[model samples]
Target: MSDFMTRVLRRETHSPRSGWSVVAAILVALAAIYALLESVLAALGQPAWLVHPLDALTWIADLPGPYPQILLGAAGFLMALVGLIFLGNGLLPGRRPRHVIDNPRVAIVVDDEVIASALAKCARVAAGVTREQVMVVVSARLVQVNVRPTSGIRLSEQKIQAAVESQLADMELDPRPAVTVKLASSGVIGV
Candidate 1:
């Protein structure tokens, strides 16, 4: 329990709440404060500055026929939508930027960019291809490696796949993501 709290307090916490969630909370707090202030001012028979700017609300109330009904229905719908947004934001987990290889015990957190770049470097070195020819994209569960050979060069996909697999094995990611090697249909002219 203490460890979990510590993680939340840390700046680089793994799964913290989104900024919009905090904004929603602040808005609710401000609304509550305004309501309390207005009530106190009305009780004391004092001039409420907050109430003055809100004279437009009286105009809205005086609206004739279906105008008042329509306005209120729209306002209610908007408020309901906002409530739903806030509820969803609070309930849903954030899109974690870093993957947790080992959690709680060792707590190894690695960024997606780091994994992709490392895979790209390893693929380039193993395949003897220039940086432009090899493109690597690393996700939570998959590593896609695309290789494009120069004209007249027939690069073996098996060799490239094995090299990438070896690199992945060496890293030993916790979740153990799959690797895929694809050869471009047409070779590049210069690169």
Candidate 2:
């Protein structure tokens, strides 16, 4: 039963650009359908109830002589631009769901929110900061920590940075992101 020994593994999937792609595709498709319906209705001598909006579209045909050519040229250019945008989007890689780590047998995939929360907890404990004063953002290449100091309390940037860096180092994140510490100019009123 060599066939029964196969391993089945599934990777997390993400469709970051598919949303915009679908939207652009829908817009193009709707435009084509509208034109087709209008043309069919007009050819068959059907009443203009559903076609009322299409009547407004006659501006393309009614463009005054030279203006018609100019308008059509502009329209063609706009359509081409939209098509190019869609093409670029299709060609580029979308948002990746998870980052690949070093180990081939095992993988570590972490979400931004989770990373931010962990960093916030660490920052609060390490810097003696209140949860309200700590904010974190984890991007692909950076982890930003913004600290709004509590009133009447002074905070040390070095200790916070060291603590955060140590914690991140312990985690052993692949493609480890750089850490940025930003201290707010004014402390919050209450805590």
Candidate 3:
């Protein structure tokens, strides 16, 4: 693929900006506005909304001097913890747990759940089992197929794994995942 197409595919497959970042931004903006309003009120010799800016500054300046050192330390630690959490959310790459299919004409980004459903369908057909009998879970690097065979019917784990692998190969997923098939020890009664 061309450079532009590659970039577009990468962006499309990855997740968007973190919601926590947006929330943090909104909260900061609100706090700033409140502080500005309080400052203006204090300058005008009017009643403050929450606390006068000067009084607030004084409280912060006092810090651990008069207050219990443990309490002040805990408050500071909590604030630092929240700031770190927000910073991490902003800096971290939020990649979606999705698979990308390379197509010559179009970029295809598939959700893990959709991939799992497709695998389940393929497993059901290969094993001649009902929908409920086959369960597929798709992860970034693994595809797990769990099958409960009908009573008196012997199931081949290799066959199911091979079928799931074949379907995955056909999809041409980027960073193709490994496949594993697990059969339950006890089978359910066939309807």
Candidate 4:
């Protein structure tokens, strides 16, 4: 299987939630609709107060005419501006690229038996190496392994090198061996 496909299959999927911007846009859309309706009612010769509470309040207060229409137009414009900002943010760069995976940490892609056998042999040949101290991770085309050895079982780089190479060779795969080792937590190992 392709590396991308494998990763997808093994990954945990989650449902996405709409952001606050979506909510804001919906509110703005409602406000714009109210503005359009109020304008239409005014054009049809209906009293503005009949369609808008704010217009009725203005009329009760004996406020000068045209104030309500002006307020509604300003409100509509502001709502539209807010909605545009939300939409722009949702589309702009640095706001989460559509295709890229975020913060990918590990890639697991090796047969378990191969890894187990490799680990077992490495532990057996090296005195301090133990199952618990080893962490085997497989990637698309490579295997990464971390090993921690118990105290007092000193190992040298040459010894570790020779042991791992020998164990991998014993696996009898066509590609022979593909493993590397690094000192993880520290136990004496010759460098």
Best by lDDT: 3
List residue ranges in candidate 2 displaced over 4 A.
1-65, 68-77, 97-104
lDDT of 3: 0.89
Q: How do all the candidates rank in terms of lDDT, highest first?
A: 3, 1, 2, 4
Best by TM-score: 3
Candidate 2 backbone clash number: 0
Model 4 whole-model lDDT (C-alpha atoms): 0.55
Task: Please write out the lDDT profile of model 4 over residues 1-191, one tens digit for every residue.
Answer: 46775446344221123665578678889888878888787788786744565565568587445567788678889989977876766665322111222233643333545555565557545745555666655332334455666666555645666666676555443223366666666653433
Q: Point out where model 3 deviates above 4 Å.
A: 65-78
lDDT, residue 141, model 4 = 32
The clash count of every prediction, one per candidate, is 0, 0, 0, 2
TM-score of each: 0.66, 0.64, 0.84, 0.33
lDDT of 2 by residue, 146-176 (tens): 9998777888888898889998887776568
Candidate lDDT values, in order = 0.75, 0.74, 0.89, 0.55
lDDT of 1 by residue, 1-191 (tens): 25764464343424566578679779889988987887777777788855742564776576654566787789889999988987877786544554545444454667778877888888888777789999988776788999988888788878888888887787767556798999889888873
- lDDT (10s digit) by residue, model 3, range 1-191: 78888898788766666578689789999999999999899999999989999899998797767788889889999999999887877787766888889788887889999999999999999999999999988887889899999999998888888888999999999979999999999999999
Error of 1 at 46 (Å): 4.7
